[model samples]
Target: MNADGMRGGGRTLAAVDPAPEPPRVGPGAVLRQWFHGEHGVAPIVVGLVLVWVVLAAIAPDFLSAENLVNLTLQSVPVGVIALGVVLVLLVGQIDLSVGSVSGLAAAIVAVGTVTAGWPFALGVLVALACGMAVGLVYGVLSTRLGLPSFVITLAGLLFFAGVQLRVLGPLGSINLPFESWFVRAVQQGFLDPRVAWVLVAVWVLAYLGTQIWARERRRRAELSCVPWSQVVLRTGALALVLSATVGYLSTARGVGYSVVLFVVLVIIADVALRRTRWGRSVRAVGSDRRAALLSGVAVHRTVVSCFVACTTLAALGGILAAGRLGAANQGTGGADTYLTAIAAAVIGGTSLFGGRGSAWSALLGVLVIQSVANGLTLLDLDQATRFMVTGAVLLGAIIVDMLVRRRRQEA
Candidate 1:
């Protein structure tokens, strides 16, 4: 038994005997309560459902497959960006430069493909590399110069906007070179429908395998673990969503390349944050930077890695935007992209101040935001009304977060 770092508040840290359960709480009841808990994802989940129900009631076509597919596809860029933000949040940092970083990446890809006669694949890679470089520079500045991310990335927002304008130059936008076969392929391409089936199969197997392995590891460590039944139910539901989405989208546009990119980015971020030792260090540092330092975690390195994650994701998002739009320009990654990304992370229940979050939060949050946007369009809502609604959604999430925090304080 030890207090570790607990100061006097009449509470001391100490090991305790196993406390008996108050009673046998049913799994369903437990889950219900969990969903209502401060850290639970229930509020957002329920809000999403309520939005769908409201829209469906108002507009019969709101739930059409075509519209649904469009919604999912539209979610990609923001989700990709939010995926990066998740890493930054996990490590207790922020990156306002993602908007500009993504724009720069889009510009790089456009220049590489159209101006430099580069293959689309290679151009896209280079664009991502450039984004990583920018992120690394941001990390360096924040660490070495001791500047806050808010100010540093705020500067980046301005600098990258200027650079994007310079790249756009005389022409506002540049279509990729069709003279190059690869460039043509990049714009006018789609994945095979069968690929969706393959993806579903692979995801199911991988999820089950991971669940089993995790349970085994927890048992070996003599700690609480996700129950097998619960895992199966949760995994099954997720699989249904993924498979249905993929199958439907593949049928819609033969599978959007942007959607594929989103999935991969989410998977990679999840792995990086959950399965890596660096991730553990990041979580520790985020939860309590001073405690983590005492425990030998390198605070500077964790912060740097978070920026690396942010910039890298921003780059990937930029490429996706470029690919989906078929061009790049001064406004390549402007508008509500950054707002939506941050909003998604927040709605997905990531704490604004960090210390608790998961990479998959991006997917959940992005989908909710995009779905609302899509629904608004389907309902033919006016631009002003749409803006109001979007703001409300974000504000609602923030309010819920504050309430959750206050409740925790009371407890």
Candidate 2:
């Protein structure tokens, strides 16, 4: 008997032993697990619900369909910007110039199209290309020149702001044609009720399919898969919630195309971050750059790509903002814009310490910020009050993050 634990006979005892039974988990255990992590979405979700409840109590119209639809629309521009912030935060970096980049894009689009008589499409392309170029410069400085991101992006913020002023060329503002496709689409577009329902069904099916595929892969690998009961429960809950939301929103304008676009982007980002090799590298580098480099991650390339993505998204947000507002101005994307985006990303549970966050954070965080702003406006609160309240919320989120990090360390 070799070591006695496993015989070196015709067949070892280990080989003959049945695989251990998968642990049985009840609904209570499942709920606890879902809410267990510091970075989990469950907390923000609960918080959102409480905020909505409070606002609805104070102002009855706050829950009305029209108000909710407007809230969703109001969220898109900053929400898109916040989405990029999540990527940068996940990779343990910062870009203070997003607002400036966005403003420059808006100015370029407005001037190129309206002033230079260029086609709208050409102007948009140029703006995006400019964003890409800015990101490349930042990447080269941080990766090749060994400059800190904070300093590099701070300089970029000032530089781009100046460029934005120059691009506007003293007019300080330009208005798009009111009847143009861009303005109409942003201001008046809404999903058809039937189309919205179909999309919801597709989303649910896709989710169910993904879950099933994951479970099968785990089973094939001889790993413990989540029970089918849990899978079914989750799927049902998601379907019901989404269907209800669609139904409620349909009573007013249904979902806006802008909201749909934002959601699609979030879904894509979430998948890329969670499933792709590049996503894994980003997280690994964020956790520890030296360790990731030793493990053969292309840290420099990853950083460059993330910066490029961040700026590109910021430019897109600016374009959308221009469309929605029917004009571009010097004040189109200002300090408040970037500050709100960062605050939303942090409040939505993205760890400032890096390597821990989700694309969903952008969506939830923006919703929280927008909800607060909207609710305050409804209460006829002054801008000062809004600023103070937002600052308090941001501070609270930071404190929570620090406490969670310390707990992990002590553990």
Candidate 1 lDDT over residue span 229-329, tens digit each: 76777677668877776776665565666677677877776677666889788788778989998988888888897888798888888877776677787
TM-score of each: 0.87, 0.92
lDDT of 2 by residue, 235-353 (tens): 88789978988999999998998899999999899889877999899898888999999999999999988899889889988988998898999998886998999899998888776
Instruction: Give the winner by lDDT.
Output: 2
Model 2: pairs clashing at backbone N, Cα or C within 3 Å? none
- Candidate 1: RMSD over Cα atoms? 5.3
Give the CA lDDT, 0 to 100, for residue 391 in model 2: 88
Q: What is the C-alpha RMSD of each candidate to the true structure, in Å?
A: 5.3, 6.6
Error of 2 at 350 (Å): 0.7
- Single out the weakest 10-residue window by summed lDDT for candidate 2: 1-10
